[model samples]
Target: PGMGEAQAVPYLMGHVPEGVTAGTHYLQAISTGAVFMGAVTYIGNAPNFMVKAIAEEGGVPMPSFFGYMLRFSIPFLVVNFIILSLIFF
Candidate 1:
């Protein structure tokens, strides 16, 4: 279950290009970014799919995987990410 820190951290450390820190802050930043970016796709988060399933079963029409991205995530979340990047970087 601890795949991220156990396996991923080692693999990422080994593959990191020369001059890259691969330090605690960098790892934390990437981990946090991964969490935030997960919202970009339904499959990226398990509860998203579960909630979608529950809603559909209750007679709600949920968007398809790509439909959700194109209709909502790209327009809303991606724009916010762009703005955040501009401000932060």
Candidate 2:
């Protein structure tokens, strides 16, 4: 949850399906993960940090990491992901 596709591509590349070649399937896997999972946490993408910086600069109180997790991420994203996976995947 603390990365973007630029940082996550390598791991996705390494975990490609056994039969999949280094072309369409490989790219698809990386892209899909980047799109869906990228929103799971504040550090999951570049914009998150930018937003935090801007908010703090503007004097808006931002949630701490653990607080964000407990108050928002886990309660919303994780549960929604589980339900979505069960229904779709």
Indicate which candidate wins on lDDT.
1
lDDT of 1 by residue, 5-89 (tens): 6788888878878886647666766775686689889988999999999999999999998899999999998888778656654
Question: lDDT of all predictions, in order shown?
Answer: 0.83, 0.78
Model 1: CA > 4 A from native? 1-29
Residues 11-42 of candidate 2: C-alpha lDDT, one tens digit per residue: 88788878766576657656655765777778
Task: Tell me how many clashing residue pairs each candidate has.
Answer: 0, 0
TM-score of 1: 0.65
Worst 10 residues of 1 by lDDT: 20-29
TM-score of each: 0.65, 0.60
The deviation in Å at residue 65 for candidate 2 is 1.5
Cα misplacement distance, residue 9 of candidate 2 (Å): 18
Count of clashes in candidate 1: 0
**RMSD to truth, every model:** 6.9, 9.6
